[model samples]
Target chain A: MPTVTLSLGKDSYDVHVMNGALDRLGDLVHRSRLTGHAAIVTDTTVVRHYGERARLALEEAGYTTSLHVVDAGEQSKSLATVETLASELVKAGVDRSGFIVALGGGVVGDLAGFTASIHYRGIPFVQVPTTIMAQVDSSVGGKTAVNIPAGKNLVGSFHQPRLVVVDPLTLTTLPARVIREGMAEMVKHAAIRDAAMLYDIRALAEETELGFTLSTIERLPDLIARNIAIKARVVEEDEKETKDVRAFLNFGHTLGHGIEAAVPYGELLHGEVVSLGMRAALFLSEKYAGLSAHASEDVLSTLKALELPLVLPEGIDPATALEKTLTDKKFQAGMIRFVLLGALGQPTISDDITIDDLKEALALLQRPA
Target chain B: MPTVTLSLGKDSYDVHVMNGALDRLGDLVHRSRLTGHAAIVTDTTVVRHYGERARLALEEAGYTTSLHVVDAGEQSKSLATVETLASELVKAGVDRSGFIVALGGGVVGDLAGFTASIHYRGIPFVQVPTTIMAQVDSSVGGKTAVNIPAGKNLVGSFHQPRLVVVDPLTLTTLPARVIREGMAEMVKHAAIRDAAMLYDIRALAEETELGFTLSTIERLPDLIARNIAIKARVVEEDEKETKDVRAFLNFGHTLGHGIEAAVPYGELLHGEVVSLGMRAALFLSEKYAGLSAHASEDVLSTLKALELPLVLPEGIDPATALEKTLTDKKFQAGMIRFVLLGALGQPTISDDITIDDLKEALALLQRPA
Candidate 1:
């Protein structure tokens, strides 16, 4: 099987990026010596799709796998969910020596990983991401969390998984819009780390826009693998996001999180808001970091071709967005720590984005011609 | 100020065992470069005692502090309390970069540390242990937890603190019975790691039994400091309890925890049960570990002189105690992994104990003649 290894010293693990990595999930877990009864956490929607396959894979590989299914959406990412899941883990006899498998999208991965981090002071967990959003972005990083009434992921831990099984074949099951959502992150990866990779990603997005075929299947795994490589590299260098090096990956996230908070939960997908946020960030990048208009539009058009929004969703209030940005944990010590592109491949951590700058970022959210 | 530096590599920290270290709480935080506000987590009873002094110390040292008080008992050590305290932390505006101060006994430290470990994926926490139980045992190691209905410390993490301020003066405020409870751990440390320290501990126990005076004050701090060093050494060698060297620290905890479980909550203090558990373990030690009766009696006499129980509670059932021990997380792989004393200063990890051995241990829990 194909894999990308993240070198985080003791916390290091491999991301198996393939067309059907989930089929080999049990072997991967057993190889890591994480063999025992498995308490698998997923969502209702994911259970219907790939749940039986995940259970059988582990069972065939010599594990007593127990499945705990939660609701499908982000609203299900709550402390209440974690509490109930912890009970299920205990009842299922998943000891500290056993492993937990997160078998779904971002919500499942986040809830399962966060639960694993605190259960019996944390046991090992394996990520079997069945969504493009989870495979490309959330699965690789050790950022597991659940939402509280006050905010999203206000409570969590950086509990790294023993292994991550990423199968791009899962993408065929996702909605077309959801596939585009995952593409936004791939564009962000190119914007911050490698400008050359942007060309390959844009071509892939164009193909997805038209339709899937034999070519899409052949190319999708490679696209997911490259995205995982970029993410794995960043996470290796800065595991905790302590310094600016890792913060660069937050290129479109400051405004993205702001726009996400401005609207009601589930109104706009994470990648859609991020796509629009990147447009605003690029506009600021031109003014603050001397990034060229050509490079900026090049990034924006790929998002557009994927049918992602280049502006904030209709009925979103700019003032509310600014207020939510202020409350963001990223806004440390009365400063908005924004990540902007310096050039095609140079990402800058900027603290100079004032209220006026935020207003300007909001202004750039107007629909493009 | 006196300090015992635990050399745990990345998880290394200093355990400051002194009289007036609480006054330097801010200096310690500042020295660690943990600048900014601190959220002080404590119990309602402790808030009335040292809360103002603690708040004032940080305030005078140019740090903002928010105090969160929970109900003062084992009952408060629940996920519900954690949920409420988490909300309080968010309300207090504590962010990732900010710090948390656990200021009270074991319950406060465990609750606050567990909260910090998961709050925003964990923030740096400072432990200001006000009880002897906290200073010598719970606060020294990074073993943070809260009780579930299932068991004590069934849900938790291995989150080490930024600094541990173990002010010995706090023992002065504790009830004489509480002070005796702390001595139980000191005896366990001596039983496993130092036979010579046992003599000193026995002498100290006699003094506490007789009366308290200036001699106690002058000598108690030094005794507490030595206990801290012994604990620090064990934790340094084994941070996560992955090896049996750390398992040595659980010498009497198997039966102790079982005894605690058999009794109603709040019936027997932790150290009291541990004292009784040590007696039962000593009986098992002689059989399975080849320990001499002389060493057994010597340890038993010290506990007896200190007024700790050599027998189980009057109405306790041996079968129930054995059943509770079976449910312990430590009873892994269908074996009762118990730590028994082989000799003075030599503890043995014995997994060969059968049901018959357990019955023998229960039979030995009779009051000394």
Candidate 2:
């Protein structure tokens, strides 16, 4: 087991990575001292798959449990869904002393954690993330939010979970496309902070099957642990994202958020949009940020091999996407800031890009053979 | 001038008590390093009184200022009001870097602060509290919240203000009832933690016209400063109310909340209900928690002399009020916890009171001569 501790003073919690951390969740909850009735907020699909196991674990650990499942999709990550879940918790009389467990993908985790943050001004919650995207990124950080009509994560709170149980075994059941999508975020993490991890990810992408077998899962644990640690370290230093150190984590997110906003939410996964965004950021990095040309090519090749989208979707206007970038939370004083790759293992924020510059870069990426 | 520092690690801020802190708000905003556009969130009544002064101060501070005034009342503390203010801020293109100034009583402060917390996932806000309720208590603690139909402060965050600029001069125009209502919170602060402050408040209450005079106004700075310090120390040590240490601050709030919920919200000021609630809690503390009879009597005498309503309103059934107690956020598991005064300077949380016991205590406070 590889353990990562998010040392956020008194709010610190541990992220445990192992093969069957799900079954050991009762022990984790016990150790965290969260008692009373445990409410598990998940989705219908997740409940069908691993809900019984999760409930059994909590029951065995001497907790009275209840399950509340929403429809599984990106639509569930909305204010309406959060209000419904909070209302259910209130009707069921989940008080300050009760424990709320968010046991699903990023959508469920975000909505459930946000509900926990606002319910009774906040209560304790744990994360049992089953999706690879969640295990690698969203579950480790304390950023919980719901999508608004204006944008994704427009309303939310920075409420950390009491414990995060990342079981590699859960990902064995994920679809190939989902696995490919999850790899995009891991790849972005590597390209921005760790070149060696990027190399390892590239090597993994060359394999016939993306999901690792039992023997190869050892390599998988360290990579996931390392990426999560980088994020945790950044969050520890700047939990509120006020400083530049934490902003580096947004290396691909500037364009990624725009792409995600442009595309119908459920049509493409977050990591897929992010993968394509990384390519655009790399192009801008080379053109405007003075990044090495070879390193940008390496990032492109690695993403291509993983079957992740490096090009913008068909019929979407680059100008429309660029317009969306202006409203981004990171944009300040009429300047749209971009986190561009300085090298394979480094990134920098740049504000010197013009609309013409972005159009030229988009043409380079979308050029016909 | 008296200044008290509320230290919560990185969220630390100063509560500046002076005669003209309102006029000097620009200097304070500059010193606090707040840049970008300033959106001042106040109510129509406060705007009619001091809004121009606040806007001028922000404008002089080199900020592009916008004023948003909502209808003034406790009803304005709803989610709809919060959304309205949030919409205006967004329409004005307020970004994460922009600063929000909450420039009214608890209603405006709570609504504005809650909106700021949810806006862009969190932004910095400063509190320029004009009311006595805001100056002494609400503005000092980082407990920013908006009321939901289910409960007060149901949706909120512990988002600390960058600075709290309290001008005692602002109180010169306040209604006598409003001042009395504000003093209830100040007296509660003293009753729970500081006997010396409680004695000082008792001395003031015994004076003619309840001590509202120029000399008394001169003494306002120290009184407000001391009350803020008491709250700051408690909130600093326990930012999130995980322990009994922070619960002490809710000394009169348990029953006060029940009263607020039971009565029409705007019918009685929060302090009036709190005064009645404190008397009920004192009665329960003496009978159930073994609180010293002499100490409880002294406390009751001081509250009575202040002309605070120690008696519950007519036609209110103790049993019905006890029912509201169960829904309080402070209640955990099957127990409804009450913050009781063990003595003038000592407060403790008690869970021993049954519905019948609470009913009996309520009856004691409600019985007419």
Best by lDDT: 1
Q: Give the share of true interchain contacts found in each model.
A: 0.62, 0.47
Q: For residue B110, what is the lDDT in candidate 2?
A: 89
Give each prediction's DockQ, rounded to 2 decimals: 0.64, 0.44
Q: Model 2 lDDT vs. the true structure?
A: 0.81
lDDT of 2 at A101: 95
Weakest 10 consecutive residues of candidate 1 chain B by summed lDDT: B360-369
Cα-based lDDT at residue B236, candidate 1: 83
Every candidate's CA RMSD: 1.7, 3.1
User: Which regions in candidate 1 have their CA more than 4 angstroms from the true location?
Assistant: A209-211, B366-369
Name the docking class for model 1. medium
What's the lDDT for residue B117 in model 1? Answer: 89
Distance from true location, Cα of A52 in model 2, Å: 2.6
lDDT tens digits, residues A164-265, model 1?
Answer: 998888878888888888788888998988788778877777787766777988887777888889898888888988878888888888888988999987
Q: Can you list the residue pairs that collide in candidate 2?
A: none
